[model samples]
Target: MTTQHLQNRVDPWGQLRTVASRGTRMGNRGILHNDANQVVRPWKHKRWVTCMLEFKQIKRPKPFSRGNYSELFFLDEATAFAAGHRPCGDCQKARHLDFKEKWLAANVDAQLRSAISMDDVDKVLHAERCVPGGGKTTFAATLGELPKGTMFEFAEAAFLVSAAGYLPWSFDGYGPAKRIDGATAVTVLTPASIVRAFEQGFVALVHASAGLDDPAAVASAQKNPS
Candidate 1:
């Protein structure tokens, strides 16, 4: 019998999955290990974080080692951001600093702008991404209002908005682009603050399947309404 590894892949709704994929960061989903090299818990904490794959030549810990945090993976920074995680300060110092700089600049509130710590940013993100009852937080908005790299839920499916159109998200990869009316109201899955970051020129790396950067693909998508 094959033992199932811990559910670690983060979807657009911030739920955990066991799908396989390439991820740039190894995140923490709390301690889920047991003596038998199996996950005994799904998550033990709420402070989910995204860290650089390697740090300072440190020896890698055995995957899902006992007493260690469960390893979660994201397709890219965009996916990670959508899943309500921030860069790990220790391993991802440069990225964390960049994120903090953009996060503070995006805030309109003077008090928030004055703050220099990631804790404040995390607090705001926590509020926006999680509800009081322990579910993912979501907001309503029109497709046009959201910037590129933002993910949203519509028709009970998750999609990534891009220059081409709405790319359907799947566990394996993104599907073809589907055009939508700009004025149509949709449920945005990504946090509002992170959405602002996208608008402020902080781009999130999307999967190659998105094809947003491919002019031919974008033109084809425009020609074919799907």
Candidate 2:
């Protein structure tokens, strides 16, 4: 329960604060990482969890949506999946065993290798990591909202959203929305972009299913597809 309780906690951002150094400076998890502090501190009631795949620490922008869902918690919790954490045994034992058996990652903000491969990252995260579980988090923009096929060149290959669709993305351990104006102009495809994410699989580092907020939510969705 300590870790659950730890979720609500906030951390102040300062030059010394880890998040601040990493450029998680703006609107961090609905909180700010302040500077000029003698010590680092955490926020209150940080009980939400990360249930997606994340290999590296990406930098996210402000004005995003984490989204309310049937089962997942927070996908934009900045530090949620960067290191690693397994599922709760009481609610997710079988998957938890599988997770532990594969890779035991607990997100640590300190400098170190987070994941060897994207699959290595997935082992600790649930497959259903989505934005702002239940309106708690979100990506403000949409694919149609962005210039279709616009390219954002970070360190990796150029990323383009399919046909002006909106999808969630995280860079340098932070998450944000990436939009493309047209399908033909880009190579990036997403569940939201192609609208057939089930078949495509992990276009981004993380994503969530329709039903993944909690046990009750998951159970309810299972009974009712709508």
Candidate 3:
């Protein structure tokens, strides 16, 4: 028997797919699926976030139930961040708070406020990642200038800047690393504000396939600081 999958897997560009892999993180944007278990809309609210796949060992038999928020999966936190999602304040409270603090510190001039709320971050992120009517928003930046863990589009494909190289991204996992040039300008898929947060020392968790755990890759990366 073949198991059918739902169209709920989100990519770095925030587009939904029916991939077999469930990914490391899950999140929602309110009730976007209909009673028929079909995604009828892109999003239902501005508060888009990414959370742990298993929170408090909670179990839900019907993930796409009509009234409940649609369950969305991302390959990893890096992918989620690139897709304009922040950590969930419920399932991933500590992560969310850390992200918020770093994000607020990095975007001080963006909001012009003494105290920043998650809603404020959501508003800024929504504007940076989404178009008014439709489509994902992107900005241009030098590939090497972007911090490690940032995702960018290069040669019509998505790649994560791992160490000193770029790892090709896919729903299943990342591919081999490719050398990166500091002078190469590219369109970054991640939101500008999130990139700023990453620059401010906010480290995002990536899959092991990113070669972050490999000692040789680390040494190579250290030797070639791109």
Candidate 4:
């Protein structure tokens, strides 16, 4: 018998779901699950973060142990960022620092101080990525203004903006590329602040499923189904 999995897989919009595949990265938003092993809340704190699946070869056979932060999964770093999660300072120190540096550099201005803490970052991100009650915060942007690695909602579906074009997102993997007009306005899934980080040279790791070239090539692969 197959063991049942919980709803821990996170999408670009930060909603959780149960999927057969456990994505590339692990994350946490405090203890979201209850003693019954069911996810009871969206988040417990503002320090939402993503980490490497395997850190220092450490393993947790039980991902949602009692009193422990619930384990969350993401398809890739881009998904995590779009979900309003930054790199974990503990498990992903280097990336955390890098993200912090670039994030501040991109966001800070004459009104803000050069030195800021992660808590401040969390506060800003929380305000930008979530609504007062419950919902992912989104904004409108034209395709050309959005940087590569940004995710956007087009035609009621989530898609990633790649160097070549926009690739449709899925629980299984990304689909064929669909090039659109650069001036087309769309709802961006990634937070406005984090999108600025991307503009400041922060690069997100996309899944290899998007490695396929142009639309024709990806379509051909999808048709062949190797």
Q: Specify the highest-lDDT model's number.
A: 4
**Candidate 4 has which clashing residue pairs, if any?**
none
Which digits, one per residue and each the tens of the lDDT, describe model 3 over residues 1-226?
A: 5767888888889888886777777788888888788888889999999877666778865668757789888778889988888999998789888898888888886556557678878999999998865489999998879998899999989999877378999987789987868799999999999999999999988876786552212222211100
Question: What's model 2's TM-score?
Answer: 0.24
Would you give me the overall lDDT of model 4? 0.83
- Evaluate all candidate structures by whole-model CA lDDT and list the values in order: 0.72, 0.26, 0.82, 0.83
The order of the candidates by lDDT, greatest first, is 4, 3, 1, 2
lDDT of 2 at 48: 26
Output the TM-score of candidate 3.
Answer: 0.90
Name the candidate, 3 or 4, with the larger lDDT value: 4
Question: Which regions of candidate 2 are displaced past 4 Å?
Answer: 1-40, 43-73, 76-79, 104-226
Quality of model 1 by C-alpha lDDT: 0.72
Report the number of backbone clashes for model 2.
68
RMSD versus native structure for model 1: 6.8
RMSD of 3: 6.8
Candidate 1 residue spans exceeding 4 A from truth: 1-3, 32-46, 108-112, 212-226
Identify the runs in model 4 with alpha carbons over 4 angstroms from their true place: 110-113, 212-226
Q: Mind giving the per-residue lDDT tens digits that candidate 2 earns over 7-84? A: 221121101122211121111222322232212232212322233212134433222223312122222222222212
| TM-score, every prediction | 0.82, 0.24, 0.90, 0.90
Error of 2 at 27 (Å): 20
Q: Candidate 3: misplaced stretches above 4 Å?
A: 109-113, 213-226
